[model samples]
Target: MQRLATALQIEHDASLRTLNTFGLPAVARTLVRIDSARAVRRVVDHPEYGRAPKLVLGGGSNMVFTRDVSPVVLKVEVRGRRLVEERPDAWIVEAGAGENWHDFVAWTLAQGWPGLENLALIPGTVGAAPVQNIGAYGIELKDRFESLSTVDLVTGRSVTLDARTCAFGYRDSVFKQEGFGGLAGKSVITHVRFRLPRPWQPVLGYLELERRMHETGNFAPDAQTVFGWVCDIRRGKLPDPSDVGNAGSFFKNPVVTVEQCRDIIGRDPAVVHYPMPDGSVKLAAGWLIDACGWKGKSVGRAGVYEKQALVLVNRGGASGAEVVTLARAIQESVYGRFGIRLEPEPVIV
Candidate 1:
């Protein structure tokens, strides 16, 4: 086991093929494994790497590497989990940054915690959760986020950030922001805490979950059952990255105003649109791509998933450049048809 302040083992020319869920080919010139907050500080204080450009690599479930990485790769492997506090109103749970998101959700359910059940089966690490503001089945990480501990790369100072400080937005957070006061690429998250409220309420607002209830005749299901349903739903809808090299939901659902949505509906009455509480409508990216006739289509080795157009899959031997090219084409077509620019969900490196 590597210690925090021990001399770091820096691997050279490291292959990132298996590290990323997309299974894209790429190599890092220099890579360091950070298993603790102190390890991050140690790297920051190191004479050689203290000032070098850094790239924090998580599960790589939400990234597209276009070429070989030039920045120093910090592979976070911090690990720990504990029930921080049990209150009458809620249970506060903490997990290390490296903990697998899905596994953590299942662990919480196994321990009788229920809030995270709606977010089950989502890939990536707990650390990357805040960066992407990950959400599914009507629950976003911000809904249950307490605070997170991160060490600044420049100052080597550790800070705990609350939800407000995180500046969480739709599929975004301060950590993902590179604007004023943003922490993007400037710090490394070491741990995250989640507050699960008592008197658990199952989030059954999503349509697919409702459909599952209708089909199974199990309307009032428990958290464990909901977790199982989510896993089943995702498996049926999204392709497994293990079987096929791909990133899940390559594009974010485009949100438009009610008026804009009405315009789109006027053009295509069958457009799938969901109304938001804030008067905006979220158009299904899959529907938009499928409407553009991109489903099951291929450009070189990169192709739109036959089952779900939102996902772009690598048929075989596909380069990251090809994936980006296909994504750009899809974006252009969708924009031309709907007059709404679809944003990509994954970070393109």
Candidate 2:
């Protein structure tokens, strides 16, 4: 770890509390920010630190490091943008993984690109988008994901993986699975490429977005209008982590057997369920938590967001343990009430 500072300013005693949205105070053993693939390779291939575990980090939005850092923290700072390819009506934009996601979306909209408008105002970096297929307002990152380029730490070589190779699923990609080094301090995402639609129709399939569009009396919506609507909806719903610490959607909507959903719905017909193609049903995790009476409840410094049950906020100086404890209590209560165990979406370290 001593040679880590040669590649970048390796900061010890770095307060990661500000880095993460959770605002949980923790220390990193060694933290280095890499601006290029060469710098990443240098740290990963160092013979002195042979086989030591590495953690890759981006904007530090969707993670909860419950304890002090365990391994080296390598913040991916690679940044750039280019028009990789263009057609008569569409274009492929490539950006460094570390680029701010909202900035990229706004840039695309300014250029009159239409596909990314629905995903406006999403938190995190472009590099982390492909991992979870980040989505909102009826559009997902997978809808435009062309390919992603990454550097393999073990071999210190670069590789470009196409969308199919990415293994994208509902809020999941190959990089997110266990043993895939998807967690922080493990694998670095260097660059991301997106294919944008030229004359795209505004997706207003989401109920709230649709209702807002109707209320605005917009019969025919364009990219900019849709982007504005999305930004408005997100701002009205999700609390900005900068002002109030929170990771949006603390839990993934649990997918369960169709029979399981039917059984639960029989008792409470108002329970919402989305039928899946795989003969399963997706239950709204937020609805389940609200039903369990955990919404707006606070314990210590952590509490469920008063407006959105899916978000858990750090009202004050909450420790990671307290947040996790509150989350566990919600999980247990929901399970006890509905027999469905909710799983957290963000990676908790």
Candidate 3:
């Protein structure tokens, strides 16, 4: 390994205001830019930081920094993308952990790959995608995930993990857990591989896509069309982080038992819900927040989005505390009415 001092770009007291999508005020006491797996190994072996607590940060799209960071920040910037292999059954594609998730999806489609169209325009980096098991519309990252390479934070050893080992759940993976065998805060992902099957079939029938098809009179939309529609729909519903400081979706839709769903529906007949295959019902958190009269509501410069109640936006110069306050208020209201606790989607740092 190269000398740790020579192989890394280390910064002190770095401003993280712009790094996070929420634009929350925070500073990293020591921030290190890691461009490769070797660089991460260097960080692990370096005497000055090897034993210290560290935080791995990607595009910061899925984070809300509440205060100045104390742990050594590993800003992963490893970059690469390629077709690893092609077979009769599937195409193996790979991307550096640092690549933008949305851009990578578009690149895959441009190269004639179509499996990732349903996930286009989601925020954050490819490395972060597996950590969250990100999903949108009718597809989740785990559906196409093959494997990922991660470097141990303590030993500098690299290991590749597949979907089964990842233990994916709703917007979750092993990387998001720290109990028992969880890899959370223990390793840094350097690259990811995806398995895109051949003889592509578009994943349609999603409510928004169905609406687009109905309006356009084009029922058989291609991958590009699906990608375009997703992008357009996202633009219309979610606030762009650049224009308004906000993480895309602030809360995950709460899942409930069939009996619980019936109880809530009895209270509010218009409650929007979907019956999951597992016999559970997924309630729309945005609708719940809106029903609680939180839409366009503000608490100390942090507010629920008027256009989409699922999002909490920084109304300009908002602190992370204020955002959390607003989120808690919304959560309490939803729980009081529906008896379900709404869980936040972003990682609060």
Candidate 4:
């Protein structure tokens, strides 16, 4: 434990705002920051601390800490990247879990790697990306996901899990579920590997992206161009944490039955829906929030972002309780009005 303290910052009552984008003023019981996997394993396996619950933290961009965190906080700082293998059309790149996701994308783009260009500017770490299966502009993390290595907290053993074993689907993974007594929260991700396309074709499935590509006349946009467009769109639409604290897209788009969607559409022809392959329909969570008149609605310091209804912003001097309350109100209102319950995208810690 003393060696662990010497290797990293072991702070008591650390302000969490500096770590998380939500800007909530919460404190950690024991925050341990580690820069390498070796240090991470060392701290977890320390004999002095036996069976203490631990929380794995990354960029803290996509999570909302609703209260003072229990257990020890393991702030992953592992960082590095290198091309492990390459083919004519693609390369296998391994990145430390704590590496900034956007920086990795930029680095890959500069090196002429193309698969991650469309995912540019997303806030968080490489480790957190796989947990959410993050997607944007018609691309998903799983599409390029090769595998990842995680440290099993119970046994202090490192394990490598492939794509199929990950059980990734719609922003979820095996780590998020529990098959045993209650739920197990004892796994910590250490690193992620991505199998990226080399001469990548920019995905243009999102209508906004297609429109922008058309506007630029770069019909076959390369990685840089696609990256630029994604950055532009994200910057213009999403609120920067520095200016207005927020977790992008507070709720996921609810996938409902076709019959349910058809009933809603029958009542209002303008109801927007995206057809899914499994005969379900994805309804716009933003539209439902806007319909409930929650967009830009403020309660104390928490409010729906003025620009994007799907995002909840912290306007300074707000408690986590206020934000959660506002979110619940919005959820209840949407369910009452449309018979659909909006699910939050950010993990509530």
**Shift in Å, residue 312, candidate 3:** 0.5
* Candidates 1 and 2 compared by TM-score, better number: 1
Residue-by-residue lDDT tens digits, candidate 2, 116-189: 98888878889989987897766778888888888877777889888887788778888887665443244578
1-349: candidate 4 lDDT, tens digit per residue: 2234436567777778879888888888888886776666677667744378888788988778889987888888888898889988779999999999999999987887779987888888988898888888888899999899887777767889899988888877776777763113677788899999766767888888888978988788777888899999999989988788888889999999999998888876777789998999999898888988999998789999888888899998788888899999999999998899988888788
lDDT of 3 at 40: 92
Number of clashes recorded per candidate: 0, 7, 0, 0
Score residue 164 of candidate 1 by CA lDDT. 95
Candidate 4 residues lying further than 4 Å off, grouped into runs, are: 1-8, 179-184
Please report how far candidate 1 places residue 113 from its true position, in Å.
0.9
Model 3: CA > 4 A from native: 1-4
Off by over 4 Å in 1: 1-5
How close is each model in CA RMSD to the real structure? 1.6, 2.1, 1.7, 1.9
Alpha carbon lDDT of residue 173, candidate 4? 77
Candidate 2: worst 10 consecutive residues by lDDT?
A: 178-187
Listed in order, each prediction's TM-score against the native is: 0.98, 0.94, 0.98, 0.95
Against the reference, the lDDT scores of all candidates come to: 0.92, 0.82, 0.91, 0.83
In angstroms, the error of model 3 at 223 is 0.4
